[model samples]
Structures are given as structure tokens and as C-alpha cells.
Target: MEINIFEIAKSSPSGSAAVTFMSYTMMENLLKPDFFNTSNDTIKTMMSTVISATLPKTNYTKLTKPVNFTLKHIREFDHSGSLSCVYWNISEWIVDGCAVLETNSSYTVCSCVHLSTFALIMQTRGPQKSDPPLELLNLVCVIVGLVFFTLALLTFALCQWSPGVNNVARINICISLLLAHLLLLLTQKFLNLIRPQQVLCAVISGLLHFLFLSGFVWMFIEAVLLFICVKNLSQISSKKREVLSSGFLCVIGYVVALVVVCVSVGLVPEGYGSEHCWIKIDQGFIWSFLGPVCVILAVSSEYKHFHMGC
Candidate 1:
């Protein structure tokens, strides 16, 4: 029932510490001369010793002190005799001579090693729940955006209804935003699944970036067209030029965005964990999309009011 304690050392700059401890029964088992110098026959004798020590008459209850150890210095330990040794933080500590009685019935010692290591790594490196919740909300936004977009596109294409040039441009802006939301949805979904394939992750990320950039470019075009219609009514007649220019700009923007995303994030697929496959929107990615749209909206708003004044 009693436990013994021994201190090894302080761990590192991290200030963690290591210690060793053993139960009385385990210490007695280790004291046996043949405990370490064991063949198959010797092991059978040790097993018998352990079984005899664990009998009801022995009544060994627990250890006197809990072993404390840092994870940094754990090396291999001997688990071979009446006493099982656990090595942690470069120190070996013994448990009970009959500790097999306390061991989980399902897991062998070897299997426990692999499973415990896997669980520890996952706990340290896995995604936070906070962002995933926001991603789920974004997904819902994308679905709603798609529905509105489809309705708007259908109205524009199929219905004879013609809103004014400005209104039509606004509709285009809505459609572009909708497409952006859809791309966002798809990117978030793929990230959630945690697929392990590198090539597939890169392709999906590239497509999402391309689509997102195109959506913003289209929005800018809509704004510019609206501005021209309001402030420079004469220039509105050059709709053919406007359409051609917008098409060229959209293509160029998407190509550039795709190239950059592929080069940066796509090239290194393994650095970040499975949760993140795409280029994060930290360095000018937001500006690349939002900046142009903001400018277009500002110009369009000013032009619309100016025409109203006239």
C-alpha cells in the first residue's frame, strides 16, 4: 500500500520537473537478483512472484506519493518482470509488482503506447471550435446567397423586365456577391472534411481563390458601369467597350489571383495541418477583393446622386 518517491531533475527552460516512484511490492520485486537477468523460465518465476504478491492476504493498497514527470525527456523503460518500469523525462519509475491487476483489460502495453501518442499530438495541434462555428454560419450564408443569385440571374435572363441601367448593374453586383459566397461555402466545406490528399487540396484551394477573385472583379465592373450610366450618360452608349473591358479585367484578375495562391499555398501542402488547405486572407487577399469593390461602390454612389441633382 505504501509508495516511495524520488526526484530526477528540473526539465528545461520550460521549468517542468521529473520524478520517480515505486510501490513497496514493486520495489521488492525489483530487488530480486534475477528480475533483470531473465530468460523465459525466469519470467515465469517473476510472474509467479507477482501473482503471489497480489493475493488478498498481502492487502497492498496504494502508493505514498504520486509520480510527477515532464513529457520532454521521456525515453524507453523496461516493462519486463514482476515490476513494470515506466520511463518519463529520462527517468524510470516502477509501479506495482502486480500492476497488471490495475492495467486496463483491453489494451496491451504496446498498443497503449501508439494510441496515447496519437491522442496527445491531436490534442495539441487540432483546429479550434471557435472558427469552425463561424465557418458553419458562412456556409449557411453561401446557400442563401446562391438562392438569391439564381433568382436574380433567372430574372435577368428569362424575364422581359428591364430595370434601369443602374438597377441592372446593382443586380450584377448582387450576383457577383452571391458567387463569392458560394466559393466561400465550398472552401469551408472542403476544409472541414480534413482530407489528406495534397494534390486535391491544392486544386480545390486554387479554384476557390480563382472564383473569389472573379466575383470581386465582376462587382467592380458593375459599379463602374453604374457610375458611367449616372455621371457620364454619354459614355453609357459605349456599352460594348465596357462589356469587353470588364471581361478582360475579370479574366486577368482571376489568373493573377490563382497564380499567386497556387504558388504560395499550393506549393507547400504539408506545413499547415489538415484543417487549412487554402491561402489565408491575411496579406492583401481581402484588399484584392474588397478594395476594388469599395472604390466602385463609392464612385457609383457619388455619380448617382450627382445625376439626381441635375
Candidate 2:
């Protein structure tokens, strides 16, 4: 599309030479307009470089040029206008950046500064529609998961405190599971709101990593205890059970998980905060969590089979 832009007044010393605003009327086939913003520094710098390379270096000069840009992740947008302003839904929208040229006229070209989803906002020439239903469904599911996890934690707490309950290892397992689920659920629910805060996101990701690893380690401890109980059913007694107290179980389960999480973080700090509040799938860091869980499941399955044979 050909963009016709005007020059700004030279009297404005605060304006940079490279910054230029383009206002153009859309052709019959062009998409609608919207503003773009992002939190990615690399994308922001890239957009600035692209604009500088495309435009003439002179200040306050009106020049028309053919510019083409390919922006990644441009299918996401937030609607903020009435039906009279915006009408069409974007399908595979991907543009670098856009802004309102004038409220009355559909024109404004802005620089892009972040790696974000590109979206197209079209004017209301036709019917205006609302957002899709899938977003609502995701929110509902997260809320439901939060409620159920809360109940599970409460039930486990009561179980731990009940009379004749001597196995602290099982209680520790439940504690780790509940904490992991609670943190994960909270992160999922509020991630979008706090996404701009890189430090907060990194912290959340680290906590999630630690909590989940703890859960898995506790599960392994529970499996070991179960196997021991099943194998030594005849030798069980109050005096012998002193070796397997709650203190011993808690130390083993918590310490192992802590070590794994600390070592993982020390080796690859950046792996915690790039995407959703989870470890980056790149490298083999993900296996730190997956490997232990797989081994625990395998041992548990073998124990189950052995118990069934007896």
C-alpha cells in the first residue's frame, strides 16, 4: 500500500529526526487500523532501524516511499472502540505498528519496538463483532482448576492432622503438590496482567520450577515408602518405624528438590522467564522435571505389579 505522509513543523526541537508519522487513506482492499505496543526491546529497536533505513535522513521533509515490513505474531489485538469505529475481525493480522493518524481520518503509522503479536484493526465499514469465545473458555477452566486444587489442599491438611497418621512423608507429598498447583494456578490466572514486569515473571517461573520439582521428589519418596511398607509388612513394628519419621521424610524430599532447582537455575538463569511462567523448552532443562517424574512413575508401576503378584 502507498502511504502519503506530511512533514511536521521544524520548530519542534524535542522531536527526533528519524521519527515520522504517516497518515494514509486505506484502499478498498486494505485492512482496518489500530495502535501497536509491545514489551520486547529487540523488536522495538528493529522497528526503529527499519523506519530509519526506509525514510530519508532530512528532518521535516515530506517524502513518499514504498515500504514493506514483515512483523511476527500480529494476529493478536485488543478492541477498544465502539461499533461505529471498528467493524471487522482480523484474520491472520500481522503488521509492525499502527496508530490513529487523526480521529476523523483513518491514518497513522507508528514505529514498532517490541516482539509482540501483530494485529490488524479495520474500520467499521461493515458489521462489528466481539471477541471469540475461546478466551472465555480458558478463563473458566483456570478458575475451576483453582477451586479444585484449593479443596484438595484443605482435605490433605485435615488428613495430616487426623489421629494415628504417622507417615509425614505422605503429608509432605500432599503439601508439595498443593503448593505447586496453587502457584501454577495463580501464575496462569494473573500472568497477562503482570506480563510487562519481567522481574516478576522470572520470579514466578522460578517458584513454579521449585514447587513442581518438590512435588515430584515427594512423590518419589512416597513411592519408596509404599514399596518398603509392602515388602516389609511382617517386620513392621513401633520400634522399627522410628527410622522413617516425618522429619527424615521431609528432609529427604525437600532437600533433593531444592538442590535440583538451584542447580538448574545456576546453570541457565534465562530459561525461567521467556514464555509463560515455566521453563524454556530449549536445551535439556525441561528434562530436569520430566526425567524424575518418569523414573518415579516407572518404579511405582513396577511396585504395583509386584504387589499384585503377591
Candidate 3:
């Protein structure tokens, strides 16, 4: 498919001569089309291959004039349902920066101000299901866990410890996990309200991403400390302990996670929020959270095993 990017040369300030416009079609199986309540009204859908248009640089997203695309219909046509031009927002198809210019049985023309994976979908109403008892069970479990986390944190804070005991990592891990779980629970509980406010939903997701990852970082920190303490107490002298101060631990715990979330946002801002107000699974943005978690799990497990062996 050809795109009408009239000012692409202007969009790219490199002033270098450009020769080609990049475009690709993705297989339908690449994305899951499970529309999870992205609409209370009729939802439009069409089984079509995903299309991405790109220039030399990323600034093609915002333009002086919108880009026009002639998306040929690849699905069987139904006259009864209406179709709309949409771009995948990682979680679902949305028409935020797109509009349908023209359509027919065989093709539809779409005009979008920003560039993204664009497609056409037909409008159809569908039934929804709710299991209140199951939701109540989930809520109860989260609340119980939160209560225990709070109690543990308080115990760490109020109780006196032996002179050599270090609770820095434990305390921070508790805080991070507690906040992360609390934010996630609240996000799900009031998702209906949060979903409509896209900015808030994105912010909540980013915070959850950072908080949860920070908790994992702290867990890794605690595991390393345990390993070090057990493996060789003599290696970490009082001077070395002074170097590995609480402040240094806190930096490693929270800053590392903050940097990750920031970089993820820089790479793909839309990856943060979705219909459910979490990381989007379509663009593999979920890996921003999962990648670190998996690494921490492997490294932490190794540390624990070594500590046990020692």
C-alpha cells in the first residue's frame, strides 16, 4: 500500500536525500483481536492484515498534513455493519488520530494525523459477562495480603534489631511490593472509571511498572546480601559495609526501576496503558516488565542456591 506523506522531506530535518518509504504488512495471527470492552456501544472489527508506514526518522507521527492510506479490504464484506479506520494502541484498535475518508465493498480510505499500525474494522454488538463472586474473592485476597505486608513493614520499623542486622533491603522491598500491589488492585477495582481517562490510566500503569520492578530489584538486592553474608563475612569488612550504605542500596533499589520505566516510556509511550490499564501485550511492551522480572528471578534463584550451599 502507498501512503500520501506530502511533507515527509520537511518532517525529516536531516536535509539528506531520501529514496524510499518503508511499509510492511503483518500476519493476522501477530495480534490477538480479543476486544475487552473497548466499547459499550457497537464495536467495529474487520479481519485484515496490520500495516505500518514509516519514514527515515520517527517524527513522521506528527505532521503538517495528515497521511492518507488506501487500505484494501481483505475480508468478506457485510453491508449491515459499519466499518471505521483505526490504529492499534497496543491493547486495542482506536480512532484517536484517524478518520475514515471513503469506503466501498473492496477498499477503504483512511486519513490519520499520526502514523501507527492502521486497519479497518466493522461495527457489531456483542454480549459481556461479569462474575461478581470471583471478583469479590480476588479483592479479599489482595486486601489480606496488603494487611500482612503493612504489618511486616511496621514490625521492621518499630522493633529494635541486633547491632549487625540489616533491614534496609527488606523494608524497601516491602514498600515497593505493597505500593505496586495496592496500585494494581485499585486500578482493577475502579478500572471502569480509569479507562475513560486515558492519561490517568497510562500514569497508573507506568507507576505500577516502576513499583513492581523496584520490588523485584529489592528482592535481588536482599538475595545478594544474604549470599554475601553467608558466603564470606570476612570479605565484606566494616569499611565495605559502610560503602554499601542504606543510601546506596536505596539508589540501586528504586533508581534502577525508575530508569527502566523511563526508558520504556521513551521507547514506546503507548505501551504503558491499555483497556485494562496495564502494559499492553500486543506490541510486546509487556516484555519491558517481564524481561527484568525474568532476569531477576534467574539471578536471585542462583544467589539463593549459592547461599544455601554455603
lDDT (C-alpha, whole model) for all candidates: 0.42, 0.52, 0.76
The C-alpha TM-scores of every prediction are: 0.43, 0.51, 0.62
Per-residue lDDT tens digits for candidate 3, residues 1-310, read 4444556555656543232433345544554344423545765466456677655444434556787888788776554356777777867767787888888778888898866676677775543466899989989999998999999899987775765667888889889989988988988889888976878988998999999899999988888776666655675845556767899999999999999999999998778677678888866889999999999999878867776786
Clashes of 2: 11
What are the per-residue Cα lDDT tens digits for candidate 1 across 116-176?
0010000012334567677678767778778988888777656654444334434554565
User: What is the per-residue lDDT of model 2 for residues 1-310, given as tens digits with 9 covering 90 to 100?
Assistant: 2333333323324443444333222321343232223232212111111112223454444434322232222222212121111112244233433332222123223333322222224321222243568657766776676577667656766656534444556556666666766777677668777555767887887787777778777777777666766566545535445766777777878887788778877887666764566776767778867876787688888978887898
Q: What's the CA error at residue 108 for candidate 3, in Å?
A: 8.2
Ranking by lDDT: 3, 2, 1
The stretch of ten residues in a row with the least summed lDDT in candidate 2 is 42-51
**Pairs in steric clash, model 1:** 1-61, 3-64, 73-89, 73-90, 74-89
Model 2 residue runs over 4 Å out of place are 1-139, 159-167, 232-241, 301-310
Model 3 whole-model lDDT (C-alpha atoms): 0.76
Q: Choose 1 or 3, whichever is better by lDDT.
A: 3
TM-score of 1: 0.43
Worst 10-residue lDDT window for candidate 1 reads: 114-123
- The model with the greater TM-score, 1 or 3, is 3
